[model samples]
Target: MSEVTDLVEMLEKTGIPMSNELIEALLRTEPSDFTDFPLESFWHDFPVPFLVTDSGVTKTISAPHMIVTMLHHLELDEGLHVLLMGSKGGYLATLIDIICGHGGKVTIIEPHDEIAEHTSNVLERRKQCGLIRVLGKEALEDPAWDRDVDRVLFTGSIREIPDFVELLIEEGGFILGPFGGRIQQRLMKKEWQGGAWLETDLGGVVFGPMDIRESERGFPDPLFIADEFEDALILISSVLGENSEEVYRLERLVESLRELPPGLPEITSSFTEEEIIEHPVIELLMTEAEWLNELWPTFVDILGFDLEGIVPDLEEPLFGKRHADFTP
Candidate 1:
């Protein structure tokens, strides 16, 4: 089989879906051209957000599932102008370059000087430097920056959509980013109308916080945490049979929140699993599950049993302290 077919098969076997167009785009681009590792060794069917800098900061090459989802939402067309806000690894930028071809222009803004230089050097070595621009500074600092872009994508998470982002968009353009703080986040889509921006929730995602100068502090907004908690509850309920009163209550709450508006109040930080468990709703559900003895595999699965230390710690609070004080 061809290498592209192998990649497609691998993604399918691992339950990571991608559109045929994206699969073909991946086939056309060479992963080795962008990364330090060999493509054959590094390409795998998993969400591998690897560290790209010595500072321990990482970038999501975005699993095939996320790439496909983001592309679908962006509605990208050939020759459209694109601006990428981060460039820790040039994997996603490289893919965008291929899809845009010779007609489209891609400008990358990387705040970290070392990573920006490294990415530019690699692309140059591969002879793919033309039709692309890499700036090693804050995105807004570049005087030559184009304000009218057809699409914008931020590879990191932000607490709120910045006002400047709208200024960067041409009328009717859109920006996609992971919105929220550490521990909890959601993929958000924002489109520019003539005078206002329209936003949509694109579901949950895990991402590192945006590399801004200001530090994010404190706990996430209660409403945001509640929304994410409800999503987890719904997922767990789906596997455990969704007919329980607890599930119904959680669903109703989620629905009510959805009716409020597109954006939730801005949150500064995120809740630990311990803090999440302390919520009255979560406590009530756990107690109910224990009463029926249905909290073993289901709860363990949602929290991730094989995730090493994370699951064990989560188990202690919900199942352990509440029951026999089991320690694993």
Candidate 2:
């Protein structure tokens, strides 16, 4: 296969969306001439498109810019501790090693024994062990590692952000990862604050699932909140009023939320407290008798939509109860 074909084949597995610009950028690289460093071999040719390309001797094009762009929203500085969950080929982890700079620390967690060993060897050759620590074990149960990590970047898809990660970040610390499944893949950033989390959907992208298998049984399946659904609810609720069939759709929509699959691209939620407050949909929904009641209003409020009304007595006949009587 041609180099471009080979690179594309490698990147295909990552499941990240690629534009023509990204593809063209990667096609220009001379993978054969990449450094003898093993990890360098795993770097995909820039899959970015519409960029100039030339053939020449081996020259290094740093991906820190790309990596930083991927992680642009995150705040980093000296003394910050970072956890790189599911460090796979170590491409992203290596970039973090560079950006963390001196005195900063990065811990790479990988479960696949072979890849873990290979990554360990590669880091050892690069003499990056001082700044980067490779863990060939489970990240979830590691009690010795600092829980107060400044950031956690899961290069793979996560069905949910692990509670361990929640404990790791200081108040106001940020976490970035891909969540959902095949069609719902997206990048999400979350910030911890006083007793709550402020989450923003950065946009959509592809990624792979973490290799580690969960030992716990009966965990909920992953379900994604779609941007389209959120927008649809707002549009229908606003223009159609709370009594319209759209209200039923919105209620069913919220009820249908399932645990999202790992590696799904990020998507916006209809119930976003932020969007509803800024949009006109909440007001229209608030005018209705069914929606104006407490249970629904509280749900809207917790999601960040503000409307004045008496709280409803929310109950699911089949399930017997609901969790957020006072969410909003």
Candidate 3:
């Protein structure tokens, strides 16, 4: 088998599912194009988070799992305009260039000067300069930065969404990022709709914080809170008994939700109220409602939304309960 095929099979063996399309993308691209280290060392599925420097200061490249998961959330396509808030050695950005192919365009904003310069040099050498634009850190703070993108992905965590980001996305465009404080962080997806931003939780994620200076310029209220509800449920279920039928059911439900397509409406519309409350996952959460109630309010307060209104309550019997309670 080819090295790419071997890598794909190895990842699958480790329980990281890979769609054929994603496999093809990886197969066609070279890891050395992004990583400073030898690609042979990463021939198998492995956690490869590492530090690189542009001018003696250190910056991080995220782990492979996080990169793949974020890409899955982006649901990229040819010709789409994408904006990336952070460039970590330009590894993920290069992978995106491979997927977007010829027609797509990528605009990247990197805060560190040396890192951006290094990334630009690499892209130019790889003949990908035509596909991507690397901008200075101050560009994001500029009111005039392009905001017509179809998709946005943040490589780092942030306490609140940046105002410029909100203005940059075209209607129906979505942004994905690990959002929350150091103690709690979850990957959040937000889309612009009619004039408001609708948000959803894509489960938990751990990422480093955004540059402190940039984060200070973010909006007052984050659109969504970091969600750890499902994680809590899993822990609670395990303590209750790992082999129980209910625990198995909850595990399946969590997996299903994690693999669901991005966007709040797409996920919420897929299931009915009967399908939701009756699901083992929902039942498990309800059984531990008192515990969840204690945790839910803090998330609700951070998001500035009513948790009860968003989630389906046993008392409410709503249609989008699955999304309402857990995601947004």
Best candidate, lDDT-wise?
Answer: 3
Q: Write the per-residue lDDT of candidate 1 for residues 103-210, one digit (tens) a residue.
A: 877788777787778778766765442377788546566566557699988887877766656667888888899987554688988888877878999889987656
What is candidate 2's CA lDDT for residue 296?
Answer: 41
RMSD of each: 8.8, 16.1, 15.2
Positional deviation of residue 114's Cα in model 1 after best superposition, in angstroms: 1.3
Candidate 2 local Cα displacement, residue 25, angstroms? 19
TM-score of each: 0.60, 0.49, 0.60
Which stretches of candidate 3 lie above 4 Å from their native place?
1-3, 14-19, 38-51, 54-57, 141-144, 212-328
Model 2 misplacement above 4 A:
1-66, 137-139, 213-328
Whichever of 1 and 2 has more lDDT, that candidate is 1
lDDT per residue as tens, model 2, 1-328: 2754665656655665554434443454333332344433344544221112143212222342334346455555556678887654454555455556577788887765555665677566554423888886465576875657788887666667777677778887878887764334678888788868889998886554543544231112123223323434553455557787646756664444432335432223433544443333333333443443423433343233222221222242111122242333
Alpha-carbon lDDT of model 3: 0.64
What lDDT score is found at residue 150 in candidate 1? Answer: 94
Window of ten residues with lowest summed lDDT in model 1: 319-328
Whole-model Cα lDDT of every candidate shown, in order: 0.62, 0.52, 0.64
Candidate 2 vs candidate 3, TM-score winner: 3
Ranked candidates, highest lDDT first: 3, 1, 2
| Model 2, C-alpha of 93: deviation from truth (Å) | 2.3
